[model samples]
Structure formats: C-alpha cells, structure tokens
Target: MIREVQEKDYEIYMELTKEFYESDAVLHPIPESHRKAAWEEVMRSKDYVQAYILEEKEEPVGYGLVSKTFSQEAGGMVIWVEELYIRSAYRGLGLGKQFFSFVEREFSSMVSRLRLEVEPENQRAKELYEKIGYEILDYVQMVKERNAER
Candidate 1:
C-alpha cells in the first residue's frame, strides 16, 4: 500500500533516502541537511513535494517522492516522480508495478502525465519503465546548481 508521508516517518525516510542516494539510482550522495530540508518542506506543504511510504503486508519497504507542476506541453498537470526506490530485497516482488498502478488509480483523473528519469546505464530499471509504457524523452537535459560554490 502507498500512503502520504507523515511527521512520524522522518527517520525511516532519511534512512531509505540515504540508501537511495548511495545506490546507483543517483549520481551523488545528498547531504543529510538536504534530506532534512526536503522532509520539512513536504510536511509544510501538502499541495507540493508529495512523499509516500510504500508498504507491503503493513510493513514499510520503500518510498516514493513526487511533485507536480503545470505543463503547457502536457496540456495540464504533470506529476513528476522524482524518486521511487524499492529496497533491493523487495524489488522483484512486483512492488514497482504496484506503485505505478497506485499512481494511476490515485491521480489518473487529475493528471495529464506521469514522468520520471532513469540513468541510461540502469538497464533493469529502464526495461521495467519501458514495459510500463514510459517513453524516453529524446532531449538534452541540463541543470544549473544553485550552490555552485559548495
């Protein structure tokens, strides 16, 4: 099951996020401060930066973080799945697919698109995403870090 994140989830959320950043899913380690800030932001605004803890048999196994934004190109709201990490042990059990289904059930009526990014080298994730009908956006992605001096 997937549920909205609550204040009580701070510790586990940080733990899983630490593992996620350390794993190949991300390009670099995110400082704990950033993770803390993210949690605080989520807690502060229910309308943005949504976070959910993924559960199976009533136990937390993973988490997903998403945010939404208006997209003229998409014709409406685009739900950007910023992070969806299932613990390595829980991976092959179909939870990822379950999470996608949850997204569809919960937001299909309101959202124009569901989007995410995957590292090109992460073949397993890419395959699963493709099987789920997520097409790779053929565009050059770029970002400018706000804290370049760090």
Candidate 2:
C-alpha cells in the first residue's frame, strides 16, 4: 500500500535514505544532521513537496518524494519525482511499478506531466522507467548550485 508520509515513519525513512545514498550506484552522502533537517523542512511544506510511504503488510518499505511547479512548456503543473527508494531486501518485487501507477492515477487530473531523473549508469532503474513509459528528453540536465561561492 502507498500512503502519505507521517511523523511516525521518520526513522524508517532515514534508514532507507542512508542506504540509498551509500549505494555504490549513488554515493553522494549527506551528513546525518543535514538530512534530518532537510526532511523536517520538506515535511512541513505539504502542498509543495509531497512525500509518500510505500508499505507492505503494514510495514514501511520505501518512500517517494515529489515536488510540483508550474511549467510553461507543459502549460500546466508538472511534478518531478525527487527521490524514490525501496529497501534492498524488497527490491525486484514490482514495487516501483506499483508506486508509479499509484502516483499517475492519483495525480493525472492535476498535473500535465510527471518527470524523474535516473543515474545514467543505473540501467536497471532506467529500464524499469522506460517500461513504465517515461521517455528520455533530448535536452541535457544542467544545474547551478545556488549556495556555491562565486
């Protein structure tokens, strides 16, 4: 089952997120305190950043975070999935497909499009995403860090 994230799920979320960051596939590790603070801030803004907990047999198994914004190109709201992670023990069980299915059905009328980023090297995830009908955009993804010193 997929449900909205709650304060009670914080510990589980943190544990899974730490594993996600530490994965050899994704080695960007945020400090524990920083991650906690960021999670708290996101939780406080329900309308902007939506977080959902994925559960099985009433136990939290993973989480998905999405942030919404108006996009001129889409001519309506667009939601970008910032993070989606399932516990290693629970992987390969079609949970990711279920999560996307839920999100699409829940937000179909409200958003014009859904978008997510995947590491180029993570072929397993990329294949799953493609199977789910997400096409790769032609444009390159570029980012400018706002807090970096000029």
Candidate 3:
C-alpha cells in the first residue's frame, strides 16, 4: 500500500533516502542536514512537495517524493517525481508500478504531466519508465545552484 509519509516514518524515510543517494541513481551524496530538513518539510505536508511511503502488509518497503509546479509549456501543472526507492530485496515485486499508479490516481486531476529524471546508465529504470508510457524528453536540463547548502 502507498500512504503519505508522516513523522512516524522518519527512520524508514531516512534509511531509504540514504540508500538511494548512496546508490548510482543520484549524482552525489547529500548532506545529513539537508536530508533532515527535507524530512521535516515532507512532514509538514505542503501543497507543492509531497512524500509517500510504500508498505507491504504494514511493513515499510519503499518511498517516493514528488514536487509540483506550473509549467506553461505543459499547459498546466507538472508533478516532478524526484525520488522513488524500493529496498533491494523488495524490487521486481511490482512496487514500482504500484507507485506509478498511486501517483496518477492521487494527482492526475491536478497535474498535466508526471515527470522524472533517470540516470542514463540505469537501463532497468529507463526501460520500466518507457514501458509505462514515459517518453524521452530531449531537452538539456541545467541547474544553477545557489551558495546555500542543498
């Protein structure tokens, strides 16, 4: 089952998020303070940022975090899926598909598109996403980081 993350899921969230960042999925490791602040933000349940914890028979299995924004090019709102992580042991069990389904069901009414970025080397994820109707967006994505810690 998929449920919005709460304060009680802090440990699970931290564990999975750490694993994700440490894995080959992300570009670099994030600072602990940044992670902690992100958790606090998720707990606040803001309109733009949302987090969800996936469970199996009441046991936490994985987590997903997404951010919302308006996009004129998209003609409406876009939900950018920032992170989706499943325990190594729990993969291949359809949890990834479940998460996608949950996203559409929970936010399709308010979103024009569901977007996410994937590492080019992560063929498995790219294939899964493509199979689920996510097309490759050819635009070059660039980021300008501020001096403040992320």
Candidate 4:
C-alpha cells in the first residue's frame, strides 16, 4: 500500500535511504549529515516536496519524494521525482512502478510533466523510466566543482 509519509516514518526512511545509496551501484552515497538536512527539508516543505511511503503489513518498505516546479514553457506545474527507493528485499515485485503510477494519479491535475534524473550507469532504473514513457532529454547536464580555498 502507498500512503503519504508521516513524521514517525523519518527514522526508517533515513535508514532505507542510507542502505539504498550505499548498496546501489548507481547512486552517490550522501553523508548522514547531508541526508539529515535533506530529510528535514522534505518534512518542512510540505507545499513543495511531498513524500510517500510504501507499506507492507503496516511497515514502511520503500519511499518516494517528489517536488513541484513551475514551468513557464509548459504553462503549468511539473513534478520532479527527487528520490525513490525500495528495499532490496521488496524489489522486483512491481512496487516501484505502482508507486510511480500512484504519483501520476495524485498530481494529474497540477502536473504537466513528470521528470527524474538517473545516473548514466543505472540501466535498470533507466529501463523502468523508459517503460513508463519517460524520455531522455536532448541536453546534457554539466556541472563544475567550486573550490572554496581558491
């Protein structure tokens, strides 16, 4: 079952996120300090970022966090999937797809497009997104690391 995440689920969510980042070959593992801050932001920014928990027999087994963004080009709001994780034990059961479908229904009225970023090496996730109709954007994402000491 999928439901809105509550305050009580934070601890479990943190643990699951940590495990997912650490074990998953694609994701970059974020330090616990950074994860804590990000988690706090998700809890506080209910209007912008909303989290949902996937439960099995009343226990949280997975989670998804999505944020709303305005797109002038699309003339409406778009939903950006910031995070999605399912425990290793619970994977391969179509839970991820179900969670995504739930999100699509939940934001059908406000969302013009659903977007998510995946690491280039994460072919499984890419295949899943493609199966769900997400296409790779034509532009490449570029980044530069800033050196504070300089």
- Count backbone overlaps in model 2: 0
How would you encode candidate 1's per-residue C-alpha lDDT over 5-95 as one tens digit per residue? 8999998999989899999988778788888888999999967788999998988899999888889999999898899999998999998
Task: Please tell me which predicted candidate would have the highest TM-score against the true structure.
Answer: 3
How many angstroms is residue 29 displaced in model 4 relative to the true structure, after the best TM-score fit? 1.6
The runs of at least 3 residues in candidate 1 whose Cα sits more than 4 Å from the true structure, single-residue gaps closed, are none
**Which lDDT tens digits does candidate 2 get at residues 82-124?**
7889887888998899999988998899999999888889998
Predicted structure 3, TM vs. truth: 0.95
RMSD of 3: 1.3
All candidates' lDDT scores? Answer: 0.89, 0.83, 0.89, 0.83
Clashes of each: 0, 0, 0, 0
Better of 1 and 4 by lDDT: 1
Model 3: runs farther than 4 Å from truth?
A: 148-150
Candidate 2 lDDT: 0.83
Candidate 3 lDDT tens digits, 4-63: 988888888899898988998888888878788788887776777888999988999889
Quote the lDDT for 121 in model 1: 85
